[model samples]
Target: MEKEHRAYKSHCLVLPYPSQGHINPLFQFSKLLDHKQIKVTLVTTRFTSKTMHRGSSGIELEAISDGYDEGGIDQAESIQAYIESFWKVGPETLAELLEKLSSSGCPVNCIVYDSVMPWALDVAKKFGIVGAAFFTQSCVVDSIYYHVNKGLLNLPLTDSEISLPGMPPLEPLDLPSFVYDFGSYPAFFEVVIGQFSTVDKADWVFCNTFYELEEQVVDWMAKFWPLRTIGPTIPSKYLDNQLDDDKDYGVDLFRSNNDACMKWLNEHPKNSVAYISFGSFAQLGLEEMEELAWGLRRSKSKFLWVVRESETAKVPKGFIEETAEKGLVVSWCCQLEVLAHEAVGCFITHCGWNSTLESLCLGVPLVAMPQWTDQSTNAKYIRDVWKIGVKAQPDEKGIVRREEVEHCISEIMEGERGKEIQKNAMKWKDLARKAVIQGGSSDKNIDEFIATLVKR
Candidate 1:
């Protein structure tokens, strides 16, 4: 009877930051826990929950009001104000939800919260539940933030080139876009820095990356907190080729028009299409957008581009009609499915960690143009550490011109550099597969995490 009662304690609440990038990996983690027979409840904002495609799955979907459920932080006065509101309102609602769960007799045993939402840790502690911080970004970025919290690396860094305890030397250009001078966007830096401060409160620190990918950063991070690698938290179909009943993550915020994209790719020759997407959030100026459109047109390579409906207005007149035969543009896509296509020769990306991992895992080289946040850092790893991509340098106005874009597209498709990058991508692909299989690094780490949770 005691054992039977203890078995019911395997319920976990997953709280991801309400964004497409943050939500996807945590959703994958929830599915993984469910595979281990742990009951999972994924919490989302009212607006985000409505947008997500929560099909039949073992994980229960729960919604919490984040004040601006309709417009989200976009409706807030400022970024600082939005964050303040999120922290203020989110904890209260989450606490109430926990109480409701307890009263219903489905008490949560563990609360796995996105590291970005550090305040959630406090909510979990208040409810006397085990708290774990899940970092959805690269381990190197986490390590950089950890150093920044320690005051070892002063921001608005005095020296242009800065070296940290475990990471490669970084230039101001290489740091996450949020880490500007003290006078500029201080609140953004504060919020990012604050994430590390709450780490000691968490029972475990989970990274959505494998050991071989960022070994030094992971080792350095473990010294501070109990850490584990249970990623790349991608769908099983893509990673291990597991043909489970529920293979897709089924959490697309936008409708995935994959059928058209995949059919278009089928028409192209193998390794022929240059796939372009700047992630879901990053915005481009009209001038830059036009430049990219012209560049893709001039490059003459067959391509697929994912741009927002709003941003599509910025394209130069007749650009799409001119390239209709050679190009395909869509508002949103099932990115994993697109990247895994055999015709995708290279990726032109914003260097978001998800895009980075997917490209590398599928053995597709990159043409990196980092926009903001951890993107520049991820680009640094791609161009410098991983050697599986090339960075597109912006011009005097910080815009990647048509010439540069055309050059990068051509460079990655043809030449010796492209060959070397392809080789590296294939190598990383093999390593990524090894990390997810039975008895592999990620699998063992996940098992250890479950054992610890059960023991607690």
Candidate 2:
């Protein structure tokens, strides 16, 4: 670490994918650094960042953007155009920002990037400071994809019937059609294949998970990369449990409709309401949406769903009204608060890593419906390894089945086995809390990871 006499103020830029799940971790990560007394600039597309506050109070944000704020693109066409433009124009924006910062007295010395945004590695190289790419998924799952793409899989299976030995086989019935088919994740797979190369370009690869959640996978990643796992970095947990009455320390880094969601969750019983959401970006078809809607209705349990405007993927209308009184479906919900609510019993999620960790931290069980990408791997951990949830099935092309959805929902919420999973959920939840508590594993890991970035 840099000594005070020769040391300079540490400057870092946090770049996240313009999606909700991607932004949540990025925000939490920046907060964790701030807690450690490091200077950070958290950047997001101006459009997405607007959601941070419904009505502005004029409070300063980490840092603002300039020259083509990424907020204008909406819908598939706009998104595609923006991405193409991003690929062609993104790096220069980063470089220009760094140049501006350096011109000011406080020059940026390092960058912490979302692993998917390899452009960050280039930014770090440009400034000649260490960069760490945050991998938001379990390393184990990423390794499987990396190995599979590199011809590591000689499985008799040809299609997406992905079954790792000793791990549960998550058929298309349980995963998104794209992942079951493998070819569907063209962009994600390309990113996965290119992930290792980024490690060489980075100072290290950081994950928002701990050793307990993924012992083997982290070990594997560490062999080839300077992998650092430190997390469950929610700010609320740092405060005393009795401080629920306290005001939020700062704005939520991501935009989620908190007021309505919190009221709905507050009404449910301790360990009773089933929390459901498919983090952002996994588009769902009508049949799939209906299957989920019907299955949740059949489960005869209360639920809070975070469904974005694009959620239905053009599904029918009556479903939401059909269960309006018994269900709460919002465009977005404050996930950490919902999970922490004593009323939330189990989580019906797409098994995105961020969602997975939140459920684990709350110690709630899962109804795993991994839409695409590493979701299958995350689902495996929830069902097979963690033993905290059941995997819902998907159809031939990778949509979830109603029966599978119904069965898993019933099993997780009311079945005899559900009771057992809930019990384990509580146990794991405690461990998660311990991991983040002072002197805990996560705490130590963060210290170590920061040590790597600390200038000497």
- Which candidate tops lDDT? 1
Candidate 1: where are CA atoms >4 Å away? 1-9, 180-184
Relative to the true structure, how large is the alpha-carbon lDDT of every model?
0.86, 0.68
Q: Residues 5-78, candidate 2, lDDT per residue (tens digit)?
A: 23334667888776666766766776666556566777766665665552221212443342346444563354
TM-score result, candidate 2: 0.83
TM-score of each: 0.95, 0.83
Taking the tens digit of each residue's C-alpha lDDT, what string does model 1 give over 333-386? 888889889999999999999889888888999999998888999999999999
lDDT, residue 134, candidate 2:
85
What's the lDDT of the predicted structure labeled candidate 1? 0.86
Backbone clash count for every predicted candidate, in the order shown = 0, 8
